[model samples]
Target: MMKITVALLFGGKSTEHEVSLQSAKNIINAIDKEKYELTLIGIDKRGQWFLCDQEDFLINGDSPKDIMLKHKGLAVAFQMGKDSEQLICFAEKTFTKSIDVVFPILHGTYGEDGTVQGLLTLANIPFVGPSPLGSGIGMDKDVAKRLLRDAGIPVAKSLTYHQWEQPGINFEAVVEQLGLPVFVKPASLGSSVGISKVKQQDELFAAIKEAFAFDHKIIIEECIEGQEIECAILGNEIPIASAVGAIIPQQEFYSYAAKYIDDQGAAIQIPADIPKEIAALVQELAIKAFQVLCCEGMARVDFFLTKEHNVLINEINTIPGFTKISMYPKLWGISGISYTDLIDRLIQLALERNIKDKSIRKSY
Candidate 1:
């Protein structure tokens, strides 16, 4: 068996850069060493790519280093050959390699917002996760909600605003419709970054302004008075939805600090303590939403279930956080797929997608 040269792309010019690095470290540990010749490619928060030797996190006692170590930093660019049979990466003065497939273990902004996917698409290289179109739509919360609602999926009622748009115009109008106690989020961010819960009118404007700090587009959603649920979806043609899991956040809502920094901040309730019918519905909606948005490799669908048992699709994460403790992996683990196996399956799906994509002719 030939070993594939897999480039594990991690970190980026996004607020989730640290989270991405953490995910990449876990992924580097899980991939089967015999099948893949893995290379660690780290993109700094400034968007510069570096070829690193120490992909694993350095630990001394309980303290971990702030960033991964780099042995060599390369300024690299990819170009498609005339034949289209191979893709080339040119790095600085004297380094080049053919990428068999790109396992982009990246999250948010340039990494997950389809910018990197588009570049890989142009080079015709096989990469993991959803395609550029799917990723782009998934990153934009407003567009994702619209598509999910169109597909008969229930989504929380919300209003979207861009940072440049004038404020103080009809704040009451939106509040009156959706009511107080809403979720303010940056439309294109992930990992619970730049998300806030606004309960009073006085904090509404400030919440929106803070959300716009991360992304130009912001979504304000009516807070559902129920449980927070998440479902993991995987595959290409016929995707599989994992068992649903419930989140019990220590804070009022799942915040960045609660999600990562604090260990006792949340508890994962596997198979979600919901009725069987609701579990079935969550799985069904997970698959439907995955298909609705053209997600291929993988995604984690989050929802808000009200006291009345109303299931509102919250959002879809194309490149979800994948540490051993993340909901995406934990939910799937409860569904019987081990972490190592899930990583292997995602790589296989990437190869299969590459074969399928190459079958189409760009120039007739």
Candidate 2:
């Protein structure tokens, strides 16, 4: 059998660029070499796209841009249309390569926030993770919370504001409404970048300012004191939710450092110590959130298990981390799916979506 051509897209122009690099490295190592022909595409911090060398993918000692420039990596571009769509990789204004599948390992902002998803959709490319609609809403905490609440999923109390409203924002009113110990973060970005746990009234203004620096919109939510439970869901139409896992953070919360940088940041408890009923509830709720949000391929639904045993939906990651130590694969691993097989599963889901979507009529 001929090997499928896989384009592993990574290193996006997002706050989590470094995180994406690490994720792509892990994914590249896990993918079966015999089944797929891999093409590494790296999008640098400045938004420059390059066809990276496979050997250089895991080498974080050098910047992607510098490595790309030195290795004469191809510059990539997308041409849109039903038939005219193509991923054109140009090197020295001559070389070009055809792409079959795109595994966008990009996280946060332009990556997970629907920008790249929209681009891929228009180009008629089969890519992993959620559709543009799902990605757009899922990336924004404010919008997602509203939608979740409307869907009958319990969410924490929160307020959304734009940077322009900073001058008029009544910090005292915000504190009074959400109470102390509020979490401030950019509404759209992920990987815990520009997130702050505001415990005092004095920290409100600064936290909001810091969050707004990451995105124009910001969300301030009441910090729930509870166990952080995460459930990984895989598949397209019929998503399979893995056993619920819990996070015990050594830090104040699961920040970027805790997630990617620090080694002893968090303790993962797979098949969490929670009651069996709660575990089943988490899986059910996760599947519901995935379907309601139009998520395809896979998603990781996070929740807050309150002291009172209430399950409050935190947020859904349409494209959760795939790094060796990432919860998505780790949870599924404990649930009996190997890392390599999990990658194959997502690729299959992406192809299934492509087939189903292609069947739809473009015109009456």
Candidate 3:
């Protein structure tokens, strides 16, 4: 059997760039070497792509923090050919090689928000994760909530405001509707990067400003008091949802620090201590959200479960974090799928979708 040449793309011009590095490191370690000939491609903060080496990290087993995307001699790039994909390495000149598939581990913005997926779609290459349309909607909180609401999914009441529209009046009226202790977040980001928990009217404007710093559009959500839960979904047409997981955040919310940097962080309960019916509902909703959003390979659907047992869809993460301790993989692990096997399945799903896509005719 021929080893598949896989390009593992990571890092990007996003605030979550460092987190992406950590995620890519975990992915590189878990991918089966016998099945894939993996090449490391790093996109720096400036959005420049460079060829990176995985030898040091693989051989020494370095910590995720130590695993930086050091630029190698040549720059790596991808392009679409008539019938195949080309991953060319450039130095003085250039050399091209065929890439069988791409496993992008980049987490936010330029990487996960459909920018790379659109490129891969144009190249007609098999890649792990959702299609460009799915990725775009998944990354945008405003668009996603609207779609879910239309589909009869329960979503929290929220308001969207662009940075330019901040000057408009009616702050008091807005607070009156949503109530106090709202969530202010950037419309298109993850890992709680540009998010703030505003408990008072005085905190509202500052929180909005903070979120707008990361995205042109900012969203304020009415705080739903309940347990934070997440469900992992995999596959294409008939995706499988893992057992629900509960999050007990040490901080006010699941902030960036609690997720990654802090040691005490959050206590994640696998097979969340919810009723059987609620778990079943979450599983069903997870698949429904995945299908409605057009997610193909994988996604992690998060929810807020109220005391009265009402499950409200918070958001969906198309390419969620994959660090060794991340909830997405950990939840699946408890569901009896090993980390390595989960990665294998995602790659297989990518190829499966690619074959189906190729069957369609462009002219017809």
Candidates sorted by lDDT, best first: 3, 2, 1
The parts of candidate 2 lying over 4 Å away from their true place are 61-72, 82-85
CA shift at 120, candidate 3, in angstroms?
0.8
Looking at candidate 2, the ten consecutive residues that score lowest on lDDT are 61-70
Candidate 1 structure quality by residue, lDDT tens digits, 290-345: 99998999999999899999998988999999764688889888899988899888
The number of the candidate with the highest lDDT is 3
Residue 116 displacement (Å), model 1: 0.6
Query: RMSD in angstroms, all models?
Result: 2.3, 2.5, 1.9
Q: lDDT of each structure?
A: 0.83, 0.85, 0.87
Off by over 4 Å in 1: 55-72, 81-93
Instruction: Give the C-alpha lDDT of model 1.
Output: 0.83
For candidate 2, lDDT tens digit of each residue in 261-298?
77578988998999999999999999999888888888
